[model samples]
Target: MIKFTLVLFVLVSGALFLFGSSASAQNGTLFFSPATGSFAQDDSFWVNVMVNTQGEDVNAVAAYFTYPEDKLEAREINTANSAMTLFAEKKYGQGRVEISGGKPTPGFSGIQQIASVLFRVKSSSGAATLTFASDSAVLTDAGNANILNLVASGKGAYVLKAKSSASSSPTPRPSSSVSPTPTTSSQPAPSSFPTSQPQFSLSDVRVDTITGESARIAWVTSEGANSVVEYGPNKEYAFIVLRGELAMEHQITLENLSPQTEYHFRVKGTNAADKELQSEDQVFTTGALQTQQGKEEKGIFGGRGLFIGGIIGAILMLLMLVMVIARKRGESSLFSQE
Candidate 1:
């Protein structure tokens, strides 16, 4: 009986030791770039996913995460099958292998803590949200050291700032004074021109019936300035350089486009002072190859010139008829007098 009791005590001690090691071995962390969680389409961006292997030391890390396909575009990630690399190897003390989709959770919530994380995103407006939920993952063993989960999750969003000279806030100034005499005086108003920054806007846009090559663009401005355009086929602009030129007028014709292709585009307006204002971007596709150009054609007779001529001719004919009737009545009166 004494021998059996001693054996049981030894087994319990070994089990507790294993459990303690597993609990202390796991960790997780998340990192992103641009400081502001936003990115432009066709722009390159990244999400650095890391895991802390308590003290056991790890040779590899594997993780999984979900993402919102509508708002973000993902490139390569740092994992077994992605664009990222092993952020830190097993020898770097406790560090993470940058994975593509691993996300972080708020530290305090139980449900949020255990959730799997994923993704760095790019958007049209350079704005989007990255979210994580309550989920669990399995930690595989590298060799002797077993890993415990230190799962974490949190929220991140992306936003693109507009380039405008317009004031984001109201400007303050001292009040004007008037003389005590019975005379009135007027002061010239301050000018909105030569502002520290310029303002921009886009409007009156139309697509052509031909291939994506031609697009008609027009817009208004508070201050007159030149314009520029940036556009491409993809949501992200990694492989292509910006396409732009200098011009005036609220209208322009864009030509040489691909058929049935989707494009994203934005405009920048510059003032005389060389200040720039940015307009919100928009997307469009070239019409079918067989579609006719312009909404409708104008006929010559239906034009203003023909209509004006017809009005003049009708007035002249009415005057001639009235003069003929007056002459006939005057001649009949002279015949009766004779």
Candidate 2:
């Protein structure tokens, strides 16, 4: 009886351990669509926040996003066709925005669209980033249990270019009496002036160090020139990095990047003669979010295996106990007959 009781206790304890570990191991991801892009000054654009449950059913979500107030203005929040049945939003400070909402019943599974925010560009010519404040963000299951540990990645950015003055309608020139005499003949000699613009080249453009949240880019120019880097998640370069100084070598670091993401970038330089040069677009991808996720998965599977083994061992022990009782009863009956 004692042996049978001990076996049952072990089985129950192992099953409980396995269930707890598996519950905590589930993970998910939240990200933005049209992650990177460029816009002209005063141009309006929209970004959508998305969630991938990663096989986990999530019922509630809270996201906090921020941008450069001087460069962008949050215009509106759209929740049409979103997975969220009810939502509330708030805007604060220069460019901080917060959104919290959830589906009432059944929650959400697989990939879901949360909300979309519209923004208008304000900066004349510069780059700005839209970042998710992970510390303040939260994701929960149907029971309102915090599951933020499952969030793998969520960060993004945008760049704005000032409208060129040349593109605008030209102002009419004032007529003046100073337009006196026109010269009939005087072609300057070719030797008296430089014919072509200065020639230079950009080389060795590469991504130096990349992490889940940042990246560093470096390159060399044949001549000293002002350095600029335009990059984005796609071929359309939308973000710009300016050194604002002349140099033969240049390096720029981009921050607030998402993990397991691919980015496209190109180099630009302006020589002393004001001639501009651009390089071909290049690409780089950030590191994956596997370290923590891998450990969680392992723990869950290992716990399950242990639980199954414990159940099997408990059944075998019960069978042995029954066999021993049967043998003892038979021997006692035979002795009584003798």
Candidate 3:
């Protein structure tokens, strides 16, 4: 009995030790300002990309912005006076906007503005959503290793209203050249502009596989674009996976999930012309705790601990049974002699 007790105690202690050593990684946040707003046809506005270290220093960042090409157009990108000293911007086939930048000497800490983008509302009335391309946005430290546990809130939507006829009249030209130039050039009335917006879609969104601590999501896009997934315990979608490359079919794997917990996720992508597409929110529950136990068995004992534990337990049981039988036989013999 004592030997069995000792063996059980050791097994329990080892299991606890393994679990105690598992620690979660630290994290930060990246978001965009003006998360929601409204714009009129022919109106132009700016949005700022911001980052919060949540108390960590970041040296580099790359962000991809996507919008509706038929309803909205990116006029320009401005990074002047931002934390990033060096930066580059590019526009691709549809409506994809890519911005990569970094600071060398002193990394950024706390909340800071990364860049500003100017967008113009086209002659259509509808909703337009701006999103960051999956896997395309990343934050890195001085060593160039990605900072883990990043919370990205780079999704925002705006409603476009039809331009009022009274507001479309041309402003009187200034009598003097001293008058300041208009910030926006005059445009023809909305009636002359295109009436329809460009269309983009994502299909075949499915959860490929889900384990205790990881999941894989796959989908196909109507057009080639960069892939990204925003997922979390709920719809807030605090975590993101940016697959910085462009493709027609996209797959992303999310790791370090909790066992048997529920998670919500959605897909976002941008084509060459900067047109962005988003999937509807979906839910999935991770596998049971048995999956985690399998991981521990593989990691702690390297596929041998289970066999060894079973052998030890069997030996202890056998010894207890032999001792009981021996005691009974000895007692019987003594009685017969008396």
TM-score for each candidate, following the candidate numbering: 0.26, 0.43, 0.41
Error of 2 at 65 (Å): 1.2
Score residue 35 of candidate 2 by CA lDDT: 54
| Per-residue C-alpha lDDT of model 1 across residues 1-338, encoded as one tens digit per residue | 56754554353333334432554334433212111243445545555333333223233233334345655545443334222222221111111221212212211211111112233333454445443322222232333222434243323345633443244323321222333232233222224343655444435443333354567656655666554455567644211111123344555454555777777766555554445665676788886554443323344444768878888999999999999999999999999999
Scored by lDDT, model 2 comes in at 0.68
Ordered from best to worst lDDT, the candidate numbers read 3, 2, 1
- The sequence of per-residue lDDT tens digits that candidate 2 reaches over residues 18-137 is 332334444555666655566889899988776656556666666667889999988888888688775544344568877666665567765567788888999987777877775333
Question: Model 2: clashing residue pairs?
Answer: none
Q: Write the per-residue lDDT of candidate 3 for residues 5-114, one digit (tens) a residue.
A: 45543533333333322343335555665555678888999987766555566666666667889988888878874778765443433777776666664577655677
Best by TM-score: 2
Give candidate 3's total backbone clashes. 16
Model 2 segments more than 4 A misplaced: 1-23, 90-93, 136-138, 149-151, 169-338
Give lDDT per model, in order.
0.41, 0.68, 0.69
Candidate 1 vs candidate 2: the lDDT winner is: 2
Q: State, as a TM-score between 0 and 1, how close model 3 is to the true structure.
A: 0.41
Better of 1 and 3 by TM-score: 3
